[model samples]
Target: MAFDSLGRFGVWRSYTGFTPEEAREYEQLGYGTLWLGGSPPADLPVVESLLAATETITVATSIVNIWAAPAKEVAESFHRIEAGFPGRFLLGVGAGHPEHTGEYRKPYDALVEYLDELDAAGVPTQRRAVAALGPRVLKLAAERSAGALPYYVPSAHTAQARATIGPNALLATENKVVLTDDTSEAHSIADGTVGFYLGLTNYVSNLRRFGFTDADLSMPPSDRLFDAVVAHGTPEQVVARLTEHLDAGADHVGLQVLGDDYLAALRTLAPLLAARS
Candidate 1:
């Protein structure tokens, strides 16, 4: 159940902006995988279009939330896509955020129950992954699935995750990249992005664990904190920052550009990443 040929680093694209043509273009650009974000409902046709358009690239959900997509429906979609695409589809599921899910309870328990249902429905553990952050969920991800896909975390968390989950489980981390030389402007855009996650307890707690105080995690996000979370500056600098996660033990890294024009950013950074690879 290994991923077909998705390289060590992949692009995190918004599902809303993705088209069949764009999906094929990404495959042509040497992007091994495309992580679709913004919880898409279990629509096998849409998923099939994405898979059908690309020959070699893997299309994964940054996560399909348990609350929004039921295990049975997800299993149906998994089977539909895998039947056609085989190893090209990777199921990334999670217990989303409490704010998003109106009736949030013990997420760990809910996630376990969901996985149990997925298991019962015949979705292989090796074909799936979990969106995990803390120790407990990360441990569960390792035991129950192929690995964990952690978001909004720094390289230090990757090191901690690798140690906690051990060597075999896939440790993939998402890093936000803004290729702008203007520090002030970059922080402004980065701050707006960081502000949204600031309210999420999981992100806040993880930042604290990485040595950021409440002050550092404030709404505006102190410069030090911004620098830690968002990789800014030239393409070379962004590449250097992203490499930290790979060096820290991440098996793969997902890059999310801050602006709307990702093609330009991809063009700028692809060469740098190629050199690093």
Candidate 2:
């Protein structure tokens, strides 16, 4: 299936904040996919808008929250996009954190039920993915959807997820990056975004699972954890760190550039990443 591919690298960003022009520019820069974050709504007009703007690049929802976006409605949106844009849309869904969702309960079971609904609604399994973190969900993602999209994860977690999902399932890992040579500045910039995820229990637990202690998960996130989670340094240094996911078994690395000028950062790293390829 065409939806099964995301090349070597892609861009991950908040879907609502993204513009059609930026999507076009991303496509021009040679990113194979745009993994939209921030839990898009069921209608997915932005997905369609970006698809309309570009001819080839894939637009995948990093996740549509399973609780917020009903399966039937999301399926309809999937069908609509598939009809118009063919294989350009990949539906990524997840059971959001308990900290944020009031209705979140028995997340694994809810995810299974959501997948069932998507199946009944005729959404192809190969065209969807799950925002999986642990082994259980990673296995579920492989079995029920195309594969797993592990968010805010380190390379160690990526390696674990790939093993859990086995050799064939897609492993599109989201990696945060701050392109700068100042290590201290990078940590400061990353803390703004990474700090929020640290507050979420699921993320914290995963960090713990991979050996991050209470100190590492601290408010500012210990420098070691920051370095492990967010790639920072000069473009070359950041790219080297981001590629760690690929080495660890990620099939595609979604670069979530953290900075004021995302496009400028992307533009700077694009050639470097391409040269590596």
Candidate 3:
């Protein structure tokens, strides 16, 4: 509920990517929150583990897919963690891609139902956020939950999202960044990273809404699209790209470092980001 606890920036990683020790070190690095992506299981022991390992840093699920993680069960886990860790955990939920979820139909409706179930199960709306992309869901998130957590998007979309959600709701945008100066290497890594999301229809549809052309959405996305979505180059350059989202009305920006050595990138950026704060 205390959104300010999740400072201006956070780190986004796969649910299984961090060990308890690594989480503690990340906390030490001064980022305010650790967002676990990859739609973690209903009983979130990993979240608990990280919460236990760190003292004050917030731990949030980038999202727990509604189709895969049942509302009632996740609510139980929320209570368990809330009881032990108190105000250090935030629940982020979403309807996953249709390609993966066989039961993914009428996503907006299903998401409303899931939120209703969570409401009945005693999960406070202020403590949760919805993964929203389009206008309808963005409005729903602002009205029904704490805010929206939009993934795989640019500052242009962030600006649009801010207008839709209004000024008060938390707009935590996930940005995929490669901390390298080589243009070729950055796109090479981005191709492998951003390319997968391009396959998902929802993401493509969302991009179209933001004026991305068919050519930009092709198998190998246009350079314009790549440059717009993923931030690369020196830490200063990446920070500038992230700052654009902040200027566009993002309350929080979670960096999903794209490369094999994630901690190294985080280490490299930590001091610079802390200085900005």
Judging by lDDT against the true structure, name the best candidate.
3
Model 1, global lDDT: 0.86
lDDT of 2 by residue, 102-124 (tens): 87799999999999999999999
State each candidate's clash count: 0, 1, 0
What TM-score would each prediction reach against the true structure? 0.96, 0.98, 0.98
Predicted structure 2: lDDT: 0.89
Give model 3's clash tally.
0
**Which parts of model 1 are misplaced by more than 4 Å?**
none
| Candidate 3 segments exceeding 4 Å error | none
TM-score of 2: 0.98
TM-score of 3: 0.98
Residues 1-277, candidate 3: write the lDDT tens digits: 7778998889999999978998899889988899999989999869888988999999999899999998999999999999999999999999989999987799999999999999999999999999999999999999999999999998999999999999999999999889899989888777977788888999999999888998998868788888888888899998888888989999999999988877899998888888776
- Best-to-worst lDDT order: 3, 2, 1
In model 3, what is the error at residue 12, expressed in angstroms?
0.4
